[model samples]
Target: MAAAAAVAALQAWFWNERFWLPHNVTWADLSGEPGPPGSGIQYPRAGHVFSAFPLALGIFAVRLLFERFIAKPCAINLGIQDSGPHRAQPNAILEKVFTSITKSPGGKRLEGLSKQLDWDVRKIQRWFRHRRNQDKPTTLTKFCESMWRFTFYLSIFFYGIRFLWTAPWFWDTRQCWYNYPFQPLTSRLYYYYILELAFYWSLMFSQFTDIKRKAAKLANYAKYQRLCDAFFMLFGVVFIVTRLGIYPFWILNTTLFESWELIGPYPSWWLFNGLLITLQVLHIIWSYLIIRTAYKALMRGKVSKDDRSDVESSSEEEDVTSNSTKGVLSPSSNGSNRINGHVGSGQWTEEE
Candidate 1:
C-alpha cells in the first residue's frame, strides 16, 4: 500500500511538472480541440496522465485480488499437468472442486475452511486456477492468440503518436494532405480498426461464456463470480462505446493524405469505421443478454447440496470434451475412455 501511494505521488508530481505547473495548463486547455500533435499537447499532461492512473490502478488492484485472495489456494488444487502444444512444460488447470469439508477437531466454530466465511471461496479458487493454468506464451504469442491485429498495431500507433508528439517539426508542419491508399493516416487507421474490433469481441466473448459456466453452480462461490462479472461489464461497455464513437471521427480527421472522396471510391476509413460500429452494436446487445442471465444467477441461494451430482456429471462431460479436442482419448477406447453420443455433445462449438 505504501509503495503504491509513493508511486502515485511521483506520477502526480511528474504530471504537475509537465503540464499543471504551467499557469497556462487548464481543463479548457486539455479539453480543447485536439492540438496539432506536440504543439498544444504537453507530454504527460495532467488530465491525460491522471485519466490513465485509474485504469492502471484498477487493473493492478484486480490482479492483486486474483493473486492473493483468489489464486493462492487455487494453486494448491489443479496441480500442474501436461496439457499439449501450448507450452514447453505442463501447466496448471485452474478448474477444481471448491470444498472438501472435514470435521472440526474442537467442534467449536464448525471448522469451515473459509479462512473467512461470507467470501466466495469457490470463486477465488477458480480465478486463481484459471490465471495460473492459462497457456504460458510470449507476449507476442499471447497477443496474437487473443487479438489478431489490435495489440501490435496499437503498440505501433502509440509509439508513433509518442514520437510525433515529441518531434517539433511534425507538430509545426500542421498542413494536412489526403489521397486513399496513398494516405499514410488512412492506412494506419485502417490497421487499427482490425485490431480493436478483434479485441473487443474476444473480451466480450470471454465474459459472456464465463457467466454461463457457473450460473447453475452458485455454491462454488457466487459472490466473487458476480463481482468479477460486474467489473468486466464496466470495462466491456467502455471498450465498445469508445471504439465505436471515436473510430469514425478519428478516421475522418486523421486520413489527411487521402483525396476527399465525397462520392465514389468508398474509402478504407469508412469501411473500417462502419464495420467496427456494426460489430460493437451487435456485441453490446449480446452482452446485455448475457448480463441478464448472470443477474438471474445472482438471485439464487447457496449451491444446493443436491447439485453435487450435477456438478460431477458436468465435470465428466467437460473431461470428455477436453480429451476429444486434444486427441488424448479415442471415442472407441472402451469403458472410461468411451464417451457416448455426439463427439462435441456437451461443449460449445468453436463457431460460437
Candidate 2:
C-alpha cells in the first residue's frame, strides 16, 4: 500500500546511520544484546531511546499527583491561596471578538467594539480584563509549579553526585573519550538519562498552561521565604565557578579540543557539539542576568521579582501579557474609576 511504503521511507530517512553516527558505524554495531559467549563488552542500542516517550507520560501523571498532595499542602501552609477570578458576564459579541479578533484590543479596536455592541467602551474593555484574569494561574498554582521544579532539581543534584562518585570520568577527564560513541552505556547511566528526559517532557506538557517566567527564585519567593545574604553570596560564587569556570575549561575543553584527538569530526559529532556550544552561550547570557538580579536584590535587601519584570497590575498588566496596552479602559475624567491596581508585595505580575 502507499501508506506502508511511505512509512518505510520515512523510517529509512529517520534511522539513517549516516545522519546520526560517525563513518564506519552501523546499527548492528550498537546492538544492546549479549554477544558470543566469553565476550564481556556491551554496546547500547540506539533504538531504545524511543522507550522514554511513554515513560515521559507516566512521569507527567506522577507529577500531577505529587502536585495535588505534596505541593498543595506546602503552598497552603505558606499562606499562598488559590483564588478564582471573577467570571466575565456572558457577552457573545465581546466573547467572539476575544476568541477571534484579539483578547486585548487597542484603543481603535475598542472603539469599534463599543459601537458594535452599543455599550460603553469602558464596560466592554473591563469585560475583557476580567476575562483575561480568569486565565491567569492562581498564586498557589504557580507555587506548586515552582515547588515541583525545586523538588526535581534538589533530588537530581544529590542523585547525580552519588552516581558520579565512582565514575571513571569523575577521576580523570581523559577517560570521557576512551571509547567515545562506541562505548558501552552502563545500566545506571541509561536510566539516569531516561529519567532526565521524562522530567523535561513533564515540563513540556505543563508549559502550555504554566506561568512563562524563567526566574530561579520563584520557589522560594512564592513560599515567602527570604534567603539569607550568605546564601546568595555563596550561590553567586558557586554558579560562576561551575557554569563559567568548570564548564568551559573542563567540560567544553574535553568535548571540543580533547575529543578531537579520540574521534575526529563527523556530521553528528558537529551537531552535538553545536548544541553544546549553544547551551554554553545561553549560560553566559543567563549568568549576566542572574548575577545582576542577585546583585540588585542584595542592594535592596530583598528579592522583589523576576529581573525581566516591570510593575504588574491586574487590569493593566494583563494587557501587557497579552501584548497590548490599549485594553486598559480609559479612566473617568477624574481618574478615580481606574480598575487596574497592584497586588500585594508577595504577589507576582503576569510578566515572564
Model 2, residue pairs in steric clash? none
- TM-scores vs. true structure, each candidate: 0.27, 0.77
lDDT of 2 by residue, 1-352 (tens): 9999999999889888888877788888776544554465467676567878899899889889989999999878867778756678998878888888556687888888878888786677678888877877776777777677778778877888887999979878878877666776667777778888878877788777866443244545454345434445566678778989999999989888887888777777798899989989988887787689777777778655545443334545554544333224345556454534344433332321
lDDT of 1 by residue, 26-129 (tens): 44444443446555433222343233334444433444454445443443342422232221122222122212322112232223433433424443333333
Q: Candidate 1, which ten residues in sequence have the lowest lDDT sum?
A: 96-105
Question: How many clashes (backbone atoms < 3 Å, residues ≥3 apart in a chain or on different chains) does model 2 have?
Answer: 0
- The segments of candidate 1 whose C-alpha lies over 4 angstroms from its true place after superposition are 1-181, 184-227, 248-352
TM-score, model 2 to reference: 0.77
| Candidate 2 ranges beyond 4 A from true positions | 1-6, 32-41, 112-124, 212-225, 228-238, 308-352
Which has the greatest TM-score? 2
